[model samples]
Target: MLQAGMHAFILALGLILPLGVQNLFVFNQGAAQHRFRQALPAVITASICDTILIGLAVLGVSVFLLKIVWIKTIFLLAGVCFLLYMGYVMWKSKPAVSEDEERIFSPKKQIVFAMSVSLLNPHAIMDTVGVIGTSSMLYSDMEKYVFTAVCMVVSWIWFTALAIIGKITGMADKSGRLLGMLNKLSAFVMWGMAILMLLSLR
Candidate 1:
């Protein structure tokens, strides 16, 4: 499990870039703070499904997965494109929603939208199934499961912390310049992740 901890550490490190900045953007938007929190249900939901898939991979599902050449290619291309689009979105995105805007934002719809975003996202697949799944190779059967669980929990903890911090710090307040800086940082990370994914494919 030592390796598992290391794996989690590394994955968490990557996440600090994209997820951290993205959370900051979400917080700033105020259009979806409550909705983002509601999205936790979806994030955890996706994490659980990913954990199951990872577990299967460690048990030799990779053999079956490997048989399909298109899967990897598809994901690689999709992930690269998705990251680029995310970069563009962050780069072009405007101000955090004001109180009046928040008043009109519906938490229920936001939660569903957040869930869809998590589910449809190619980056999530690469992170959880590709990275975390491969990391499982470093351990035994029992340890692999334990590691998967830890990784899933880490994702949940990270997102929850981001949401809570954004809400509490008033860091998303429209008046603050910090919010803009955070979004720019998010755009950079998105671009970085795109480049990294593209390189990994080659």
Candidate 2:
């Protein structure tokens, strides 16, 4: 069980370490909000979406996904489009320097966007299904449960830490210029990911 937990933790950490759409969105929300607590809904929503994906993957739903090429294609296309649109939005966004001016997303908007980024991302889906799901085949019963639990815990911890980091950085840089630069960088990253997915479609 310990070994399974360790494997799951390490694997999940590695998979999530990348600067993907979900992480970028979480970080942005954290940095954009007037208070770190305001970002909790986005963070929690994202983690929940990941939990669902991981759970589905462990249940061998990925096997069914693999059999349906059209479904994968449709998801990939949608992901690409969504990423591009989000990138444009981020690029055009202006940083808010004051609480009154801060355009923080409402809880509902945050939850919806978080779910979309986490659930609609084909790369994320593939990672959970392909890597996490495949890795689970080596474990059974309690070990499997431990493994899943560890992975889910890691997701929650990582997102919380990420939000805190963003909040700290925002507090330090009151000028908002750094946040603007980050938004542009995030936009670039999203567009790059979208392009990569588009290429893979062919």
Displacement of residue 136 (Cα, Å) in model 2 is: 0.7
- The residue-by-residue lDDT of candidate 2 on 1-202, one tens digit each, is 9899999999999999988889988988888888888999999999999888899999998669856989889888888888888888889876667875546777887898788788777877888999999999999999999999999999999999999998888788899999999889989988998998899889
TM-scores of the candidates are 0.60, 0.95
Q: Which regions in candidate 2 have their CA more than 4 angstroms from the true location?
A: none
Judging by lDDT against the true structure, name the best candidate.
Answer: 2
- List where candidate 1 sits over 4 angstroms from the true fold: 1-53, 60-67, 100-147, 171-174
- lDDT per model, in order? 0.56, 0.88
Q: Candidate 1 lDDT, tens digit per residue, 33-70? A: 44455445434444455455555545667446545778
For candidate 2, what is the lDDT? 0.88
Global CA lDDT computed for model 1: 0.56
lDDT of 1 at 130: 63
